[model samples]
Target: MRSSVKALREQGVWSVEFTEAQYDLLVRSMVTFLAIEKERFARVVTVGPRAEELDAIISGAERVHGGKAVIRTSLDDIHMIHSMLVFLPTLFTSEEDFVTRVGFFKENVAEVAAGLKRAIVRTAVDV
Candidate 1:
């Protein structure tokens, strides 16, 4: 799963025919991943071409406390996610790529959840 997703990321700058459920999974995992990475490295992450947008996303994710709603993204959120992190599907050519991407997330959600938990733990300790 991760291999296919990584392959799609390798190509870059593309789209795929993703169903709503697939989009939800990808969006959820991507956002959660971004949120944790942002939290785990907030200071350095403050700088980048897409910093502001990514910051805004992480902020929202934090506000929701990185809940399921983070994955229930709008078109704008989808576009934003496309521009940041590992990026999205490889092409708009088929649903297969989309399914592969989403499957990658589904397969890795527990990992993302653990990372997110650690991130939250760090913040709580500091607070």
Candidate 2:
């Protein structure tokens, strides 16, 4: 998953950019799909990126006066699993576009989730 994320990060600049609202909606949907997969599969999910990495990104964004970033890093470990089981099939695209979009959002979600995890960790560390 980490390797896939790294590849997406590299290829993302060339892909379509989704609006913030779209991104949020996609993430939320992906998360819900993940929950359903967990229930159906009856197994534990792993978070991909570490929380500390997510926190560092958010902290930097805050310093730059970025508005609230709603990327949910806490959900990374399960993003891929959920994506595979739920989101991918429903995208309704040609195999090429579906593959492209999946790779693109997978990375986007992972990066966001990693940042959120970092923020979560930092808050915990400070307390």
Candidate 3:
């Protein structure tokens, strides 16, 4: 799954240039990847003083997911999410630890997902 995500990222799958149908397919693929990793992310653990900060980040992401805020999706935002999903894990001892310590919070995963949703809505409207 990670390799597939990396391959998509390398291919610039999130670029704004994609046709609506193509973008929709890519988004579905991304959503699937996230779903597959959800259990792993939930198992991540954080220790030390930085843990609180990480918790706050997760809370913020939850709020975003809950529609407490509006996020404008940009290509760069999509790229950031891809980087978090693909590259960030390699920097830590484990994928779970990476997520616990900094993944959702640092990467603003919810906001980015919201932004992607907004982009999709915009595309639907445009169509």
Report the lDDT of model 2 for residue 24: 46
lDDT accuracy of residue 68 in candidate 2: 23
TM-score of each: 0.27, 0.33, 0.27
lDDT of each: 0.38, 0.36, 0.36
Q: Write the per-residue lDDT of candidate 1 for residues 3-65, one digit (tens) a residue.
A: 121101112222222333333554554554454445544423333344445445533431232
lDDT of 2 by residue, 26-81 (tens): 44545444544454333232323342232232222211122222222223432433
Count clashing pairs, candidate 1: 2
Over 4 Å off in model 3, which ranges? 1-68, 103-127
Please give the lDDT score at residue 34 for candidate 3.
Answer: 44
| Location of the lowest summed lDDT over 10 successive residues in candidate 3 | 1-10
TM-score (C-alpha) between model 3 and the true structure: 0.27
Q: Write the per-residue lDDT of candidate 3 for residues 15-49, one digit (tens) a residue.
A: 22332323333334334334443554332321222
